[model samples]
Target: MYQQILAPLFGSLGWSAVAAALPLLVLFALLGLVRMTAWKASLIALAVALAIAMFVYPMPVDQALLSATLGAAFGFFPILWIVINAIWIYQMTVTTGHFDVLQRSFSRISGDRRIQAMIIAFCFGALLEALAGFGTPVAITTVMLLALGISPMTSAVVALVANTAPVAYGALASPLVTLASVTELPLADLGAMTGRQTPLLALFVPMVLVGIIDGVRGVRETLPATLTCGITFAVAQFAASNYVSVPLTDIIAALLAAGATVLLMRVWTPRGAEPPTSEPAGSRAEVLRAYAPYLIIIAVFVVAQLGPIADLLDAVTLKFNWPGLDIRDAGGEALSLTEFKFNWLSGAGSLLLIAGLLTIPVIGISARAALGRYAATYRQLAWAIVTVMTVLAIAYVMNTSGQTATLGTWMAATGGLFAFLSPILGWLGVAVTGSDTSSNSLFGALQVTAAEQAGIDPMLAAAANGSGGVLGKMISPQNLAIAAGAVGMAGREGDLFRRVLPFSLGFLLLMCALIALQATPVLSWMTVM
Candidate 1:
């Protein structure tokens, strides 16, 4: 192994680091070029990663496998837990007919396809991203846009793009919580810096989403609404993350945007000819019944996740760290690794259960139908869960194995242009797996380290890692599968990726520009001007 993988390379490096990294580069190359399915790619990557750890990096094999297993399990349950429940809640709305009201409500706000896409997928979805993120916004907003007669491709694109601005604060700001715990940056400081950094991205998101949907004309027409949503979202993200705990930022931000947009849409009509009229409204009682469960879920989720009563429930949490995966600080000191344990009482999963209960009575969902739908949504999410687990396992291995360090060392050699290259690393992460959570988990720490080494502010760089990563979501193999599954576009995943690549590249450029601004003294303009 050393002869073929290490000797000549080591000669140049004067060490075995070269041998240690060959496996990693090969794994990434094969995945990038072969267009292999995620499962296969993850397996291959894991295998090479294992080999590197044991032979080159000298990590114990059992320990390596155990770490990978624990990481995989974490990816499968709670992460997948969020995705499945989010889809189920939306499915519950659809199966019970409340979706029609949702569609009409969106249309009444702005019937133009572009504006509607911006509102539902961009602004509204960002709110959801802030609230329940993971895959929730995409599942809900895409379905709603489709219900409103937007093309399936358009809906998926809009949802994926809108997913960007709110991700750091998503699912009640879990990302920031994770970032804080890992970095030991004051949660408030990280939250505040992320808030300051992300709203900067938020400012441009609506303009990007609208331009994508209907071009300059559409952007111009919906400028008022777009600007309002972006500013509101940015300002809220800045304040919520700065003042409040990270865990509640997304929840509060999303709810505020939803409430504000809902209230505003009542009186704020937009310019241009609206689309075709939607069907008449459903009975108020029917709408109320249809939505009761979701209301309960949100209510319970909010109270349990935060609020005065949360401590009582939170007292019953499941907490522990994965043993044997001690990471390092900037120096050689080992960083404490605590993967927050699942708390059944206060965990997001429990809130989902609460939502379902409140929803069942309100929607008049028969117990039989509710059980059937819940089961079906689980089945739908199972493979996705597997995919996330598999990919995350590989990612965790690479991260803990110091493989990312090996890679980061090589990349950081490009001193001045590191800002430009930074986004690609984030992009490749999300491109491999659909969810930004997965991407951020895979690279968030790496970005921080890279930023510090490159003499850049870690928060600006970390936020760019997130914002740039969002562009890849549209083309992620998992996302393609979901959208295709939703619209019967299966077996044509390649076609969809091919179609979306240009837009993906374009938006990535926009994000890259935003990230570069942070490093450049001139970027004060992007923030101030």
Candidate 2:
């Protein structure tokens, strides 16, 4: 088996770390500075990473190729698979003319652009994040925001930003679960600490969404509703994660947040906001029919996640060790190097596809037309698929070649200030991998290790990894591609990244401060014992 060499070329950790980071820097410069399309930038970055893996890190050629292939397979099977089918269901609704009715139903709730954003992007998006995650919220919510007459760019930005708070607990709290597993901490402790940290962001995000949607006026006029949504969500999140159930944290929080927003609107309307021009109310049957697609989605996802059904579906899962990619870390611990966990039956993508197929008869579309829509979606998402795959391949290369470990090892040398720097590792992990769960798996142990060295609570440090990583989702290449596709801005992933970068960085800084304070006596009481 070929082993990775962290400082293969320069024999210096500092120079090796910089060499390891060159591909990511190239990717960011190309996408953020040179304004390259995501697909092209990803391709170039993958090329750079391969060269670095083979030369600077000195990974064998066969291992490098297999790693990239495995990453691409994973990108297609689960990640892009979910994106394609979720958008296909939305397209099916549009084809059947139900989307218009759905839009009217939402407008009936509130005509104000700000309120619509709060409902669709913040509240409803959280529900999606809970159920499906992995770009599902960005894919679905951006489209919904567009249907409500928001600009495509604004819709994409709002969806990305609103997706943050729910993400630590997303996919049934998979990120926290991964953190617990990696750090050997109790799930309850990790959940509670994450609960403490992310709820602060939960309480702040709705206001930020409003600010993004309509500037100072939006925040000023909709202050009551925004505060209500954020505070209720935060309280519910903390209670659910700490006391009730970790997996159901986002779901319960989302339901309560939406309910609170509706109740608040019953007595208060924002000043200067005109009532939406009343549209003809559909019959109860018509409204339910219009919502049948989502109802089907909920049913399929729920059934698929049921214990027995999930077990049966998981039985069909295909797991394989990546060839020639196994490597050990500095401490002689073997890295968990595997690839393409093809959860064919139980995956969210399959559930979404089942939901779309069920929609065909409900929405009055023939099989032929539904197939046509599927093909059209494939054509539209062609570049996005390539972008995701290439980026993931780059991530795989970085991980297998020890480049990621190099960066983390260098960061872990921060000593006492490692508390402030802990979340940055998480942020970097997710920004590179496009997944909070993946980030936790990558850096969870590192956080605990660094915390022990620096004399801080390992639980708090590990939780910070997950909590802060959520911010990076907004600017991740996979998310940018999904957001671009959702808004019909296929080649403009760069634009979406640029729009969300400020919010991502701003939240990262806030999380750093929160984590830093928790490490000290000032906010030590905030953490779970």
Candidate 3:
């Protein structure tokens, strides 16, 4: 590993860092600038990582293999699990004919297109994100928008934008929980800090999305509903984060916001009546029964995550390091085994499955039809699942192989502006993978390390990564694909990205400023990253 191999490449600390991070930059550029498929770009990034590990960083081949395999596995389980189940639950409704009733009910509540966008894509999505996360909101929200006759591109963008506020507290507070675990920070503090920060944005993203879709008039008309929705979410977020468990914030807040909207719709109609519906009304009890599955899911997840039950369920957990993969410092020394392990039972996947099981009865479809619907759902989502898995695999390969770290280090050394560069790192991770969770996973450690070196609050930097990651969601390849498919622009993926790019970048900058402000020593303790 010396002279001809590691020395020429990883010989200097500076060189090693550059080698780790440059490929990551190139990966994002290829996707953002060129509009390549996520998996395709990921493969290119992975190849670069392999080169670094074998010839530059010179890790043992076995470790590299193990790490890559483990990373891919991590991508599949819980993450894919969540995405697939969401689509399945929705499919059960569609197949049962109850979904049409559900739609009619939603229409009856608030038929104005703009308000529908707010309640479903923005507000309802938050409920799911908080409850189940891992692409569930997007999957559920995107489909709902499409059914409502909202353009697919519009649905995708709104859902992506709407997704922002719930993300930090999403998957029942997974990001905050993960951050605390990784950094040894207090879980409650991390939850409170990120929670307060998210609601501040959550209060506004809905209105912003409305303006983007419907212009100024749309914004004006929906002001009252927006305030009720936004304020409820923000206050709930702040209170929950500061005083309660991270997982519970989105759940309670979403329930409150959704409740407020439902009540408001009953008493206050908008300027125009709802869109006309040809569908017949079903019994309210039947509708309630139809929705029982979701209620059960939430109830089960809460029980599963709480107190003795959660700890007892812990026995089912299986933890082991990903095979062969190892990290190294500038000196080419290997990282400890603690660097790799799949977090399974504690993950959202388990919750999703439990939710799905509970939802099956509520779906109310018979066995034969249920199987048929499941098959059809799979057929419709084949491209999405393939895209998600491949992209994740490549992301893991590139990361575990050490190329991303080298590249971040290189950028850090050359560009000493921590605040400016730090957000960019988070932004790039999101741009590549299109998942905030993935973005945080990729750069969370790096952001903290950079902040410490720069002498800023580590929590602030970690939060910045999450904040910037939201911008990438609008332009990410996976997201673009969903948008294109939703809008019947199947291959026009590039067009969707081009359209949303500006807004994504703009909001991202705004978030970065917010994060920087929150990170100050005086305010830092007030909000955890």
Candidate 4:
């Protein structure tokens, strides 16, 4: 097996690290500076990564090609799988004329755009993140915002921003699980530290969403509702993640936040709220039918999560070592050899596909019509498919060739200031890989090692990796692809990325401050022992 060499070119770690980052820099420059489309940028970036892997890192050609193929396969099976079906279900509602009723129902709850954003994008979106993450929340909620008459670009941006807070606990605290596994830290302590850190973001994200939706005036007018939602969610998240079950943390938090928002709406209305646009309030049964798709999704996901069902589903999962990709890291540790387990039955994508199919009868559409809609969804998401696959391939190539490790090793040289930079490692990982779980897996041990060397609490640094990684989700290419597809801006992934970059960076800075404080005596008491 070929082993990675971090400082491959000049034997100088700094220069080698800079060379390793060229592919990402190319990606960002093309997307942000040249304003190229996401698909083109991602494809070019993938080519750059392959060249660097071969010439600089000098990875074997067969192994590099296999890595790219595996990444592309994963992107299609699980990532695009979820995006396509989620949008398919929404399209079913539109085709059946039920989306109009759904829109009217939300309007009746709160006519103000600010309140609506808080309720749907922040609150309901968090619920989706808790249950069916991996682009589900962004895909579903962006479309919901569009149905509310929000502009496409604004809807995409708002959904991306609102997705941040719950992501640490998302998919049943998967990111935390990955962190614990990587750092060999106590799971509970890591959860508690993460709980303490991310709730700060939770308390402020609703305000950010409202500001994005309607600016400072929007935040000012809807201050009470925003505060209630944020505070309630933050408190529940902290309590559940620390004191209660980490796996159930986001579920409890999302439900409580949604309940609080609805309860507050009964008594208060934002000042200067415009009159809601009038639409036919369909009968109660029709409204319920309008919601049937999501209900089916929830029920399906819950049942799939049951122990017996999950075990049975696992029986059919395809697992194997990826062919021609066995390799080792610079430290002579063997990299993960297991290929992507094709979790066909239990995956969120399969569940979403099932949800879409079941919605056909509920929405009174024939199987042929549903199939046609599904096909149309594929057509709509063509560019998104390309973009996501290319981005994932780039991530895989960089990871396997040790390009990511080269960068991480360079960052670890920060010494005492590494406390402040810990979260940035996680942020960069997630920004490249598009999953907080992946981020924690990539950087969690690095955080621990860096902390030990820097004379800080290893657990605190590792937990910070997870807490801060959530902020990167909004700006991740996979997520931006999902948002762009959901909002019918399939080729404009860069636009969504540019819009959410500020929020992502701002949240990263806040996380750095919080972590820096925890490392010092100022907030050291907050770190879980």
Superior by lDDT: candidate 1 or candidate 3: 3
Q: Give one digit per residue, the lDDT tens place, for model 2 in 1-529.
A: 4566666656888898899999999998888899999999999999999999998878888888888988887788788999999999898888887888888887777778789888889999998889888988889889989988889999999999999999999988889888888899999889988999999998889999999988998899999999999999999999999999999999999999999998877778898886764776477777887889887987888788789988998998988676656666655666675644768888899989988888898878889989999999998888899999999999988998889988988898889999998888999999998899999998899899988999988998999899889999998998899889877898888888888999999999999999999989899899845
User: In order, what lDDT does every prediction score?
Assistant: 0.64, 0.88, 0.67, 0.87
Better of 2 and 3 by lDDT: 2
* Superposed Cα deviation of residue 202, candidate 4 (Å): 1.2
Candidate 4 positional error at 439, Å: 0.9
- List model 1 lDDT by residue over 399-502, tens digit each: 56555555545555566677777777667667654556656665677777777878877766665666667677776655655554444343444455555677
TM-score for each of the candidates: 0.80, 0.98, 0.85, 0.97
> Residue 85 of candidate 4: its Cα lDDT?
86
Ranking by lDDT: 2, 4, 3, 1
Q: Candidate 4, residues 384-417: lDDT per residue as tens digits?
A: 9999998999998999988999999899989999
Clash list (residue pairs), candidate 2: none
Q: What is model 4's C-alpha RMSD?
A: 1.4
User: Of 1 and 2, which scores higher on TM-score?
Assistant: 2
Clashes of each: 6, 0, 14, 0
Residue pairs with backbone atoms closer than 3 Å in model 1 (clashes): 130-250, 172-247, 289-363, 293-358, 293-359, 297-355
Q: What's the true lDDT of residue 127 in model 2?
A: 89
Indicate which candidate wins on lDDT.
2
Residue range with the least summed lDDT across 10 consecutive positions in model 1: 1-10
